[model samples]
Target: MQDLNPTGTLHIGASDLEYRMIGSAPADAPTLVMLHEGLGSAALWGDFPDRLAAATGCGVFVYSRAGYGASSPVTLPRRLDYMHVEALEVLPALLDAIGFRRGLLLGHSDGASIAAIYAGGVQDHRVQGVVMIAPHFIVEDISVASIAEIKAAYETTDLKSKLQRWHGDVDNAFYGWNSAWLDPKFRDWDIREYLAYIRVPVAILQGADDRYGTIRQIEIAREECYCPVDVTIMAGAGHSPHREAAGATLEAIVEFANAVLQGDEGARGRAA
Candidate 1:
């Protein structure tokens, strides 16, 4: 519902999903598709996306996932494959509908997992690269413990009201992500097997003090991803690097984007 100027809004699905797109560039400028965190939305990005779009000369786009911000709430119970379905089916359809054939992806937390799956499944050469911020390749006990704490905080504190400001309907964003994660059957979820199959370059960023997951998650990603891997860790940052250490996170990502945008511009540059 927010106007992002150059890149207009659109209702993209049967659910009337509304998204905010920012920046304008040549059709050839690499698109930067932003995927938000578990309880995040377009507004929750809090100028991070705009700063990123300005830093890199790429177009930026972000949307509230179903049940997040302005997007419609989930109509039914979600299965374990919810993330996979979003990556494999919804993302592809969204890109095709919006004319984003080639782009670099910037995904945080759960979103990072989706980007990895999409990059591996779709063998498009134009898919450039990925920058995963605090990604989870496998579930960790630390994460579970933190989730339990969060649930407790929600029950006994103002956490729900605080989140409700960002998401008008608190339960939609809260339970949709919370229940899906805490489900007993969800422990079997893992995306590591797809890392080795990812052909595009990947830059994995993690915080040394991340509360959601530990450094082990990024280590798992680096160990499994066969392509060129760049791992960065910000000492004092937590689950949200962009907010915790914006300068460092942006600096690192700008460097990565430059390399990705360089592409074939070195020798046989393909004009788009």
Candidate 2:
């Protein structure tokens, strides 16, 4: 297979997923696969992937799931277990289709939960570690409340127009994520059960003032995951740490990624 990094569309399952590669994927260095947030896309990630590749000297692969960015759209009335499907079916297929050798998964918000689920559900040895930013283990009332606010913003404010700049079909991107989270049945959705199965190292980054969820999400991982678990709580930061505290978040992730890729066990040390 060619080792060149390319930006293009991949035909996976019934959808055409959009992705871009940063840096080369050599045998020695592991790649970093970035999964975007609920309303986020590859373009929305901005220069984070580039900065990460330069900082950690690891290849970075970023993609937009179906219904976001330039990818194909999905049907309405998405299942409440949408994240589960993404983890079990779509994510694994994406890794295989991309010829993934060894890599770390970096995910944000909904992406983080999806990454955690994938790590626990799939026993793929190629996945050395995972970096979850603002992950949710179990649904919270605060999460539902904040999601409700976003839905209101989408309708009343220019949030939709702003998101349209990033997503190809803005409604597909917004409603697909919004409708599911706001669904009353989704409150019972929980992935903490999968935590025990995660054998690889896990690093969790969350903001101190996040409106979507509280630190209980992190506690679940520490209690359930037997593997090395590293946690970081950014001071004065909100839901999106990478965006709210970009410098600090980037530094931590770069350090952790380098350590994990180098097979350093002590990298599991916690930070605040």
Candidate 3:
């Protein structure tokens, strides 16, 4: 692994995504591609990627999707199927652009949903496994209610300022996600069907006290996915377990990646 500035950018479609690639070269190890939360950016992930790289010996690629961080801004009133677009369109372009041959798709919050959708929808062979942290498989009343509260905080509190530190155009990042979820029609937005087709191993991690979602997300995965799933519900954490329960989250992720990748070379060799 090289020691370099944890900041760089990639041009994907009309968007210039800000990213930081950590750990060894992609050719030397599996690349753990990270997708940020709804209001998250590469910066918001803090030292978790570094910790993950150190723990798992895998290259970590963390990027901010369009409308977040220094990535390109997005048009407002984003469609409810925005996650689908990202999963089916943007993520494929990103993986190809980065020359990803084999890796894990690791996502949090909305990012997790996108990863799940891509893994199940596209069924790409390059993806060896998925690590979904605080994923939402379907719309829930608790989720909407909490998101509504976040909307209020963004207006009445310094939440905007806090988020602006990470997002280039904070409103575009915030409202693009918030508005779509709050939309009446979005209540019907569901990606549970995507879970059934995922062929690779999956690790689902959630905070026990997560205000944004419930254990129903894990139950949905267990019921739907045909692949191996490792589930962990951290006792004292909240929405951001990687941040709130860093030690446990890191340990679980490291173990999961190693186990999944252990026989990858043998499997690929046999297939070839």
lDDT of 2 at 99: 74
| Residue lDDT tens for model 3, 6-26 | 567778888898889887655
> Model 3, poorest ten-residue lDDT window?
263-272
lDDT of 1 by residue, 1-272 (tens): 22334544455565555566766532445678888888888789888888877777677878777777877788545677888987887777777656675678889998998899888877667678998999988888888889888988998999998998888677878878888888888899998888888998898889889989987887787788889989999889999998999989988887887777775332122211
In order, candidate lDDTs are 0.79, 0.88, 0.88
Pairs in clash, predicted candidate 2 = none
Segments in model 1 whose C-alpha atoms lie over 4 Å from true places? 1-9, 25-28, 263-272
Residue 16 lDDT (model 1): 52
lDDT of 1 at 11: 58
Candidate 2 has its poorest 10 consecutive residues by lDDT at 263-272
Per-prediction TM-score: 0.91, 0.94, 0.94
Clashes of each: 0, 0, 0
Question: Which prediction has more favorable TM-score, 1 or 3?
Answer: 3
Selected candidate, larger lDDT, 1 vs 2? 2
Report the CA-based lDDT of candidate 1 relative to the real structure. Answer: 0.79
Weakest 10 consecutive residues, lDDT, candidate 1? Answer: 263-272
Off by over 4 Å in 3: 1-6, 263-272
Q: How close is candidate 1 to the true structure, as a TM-score?
A: 0.91
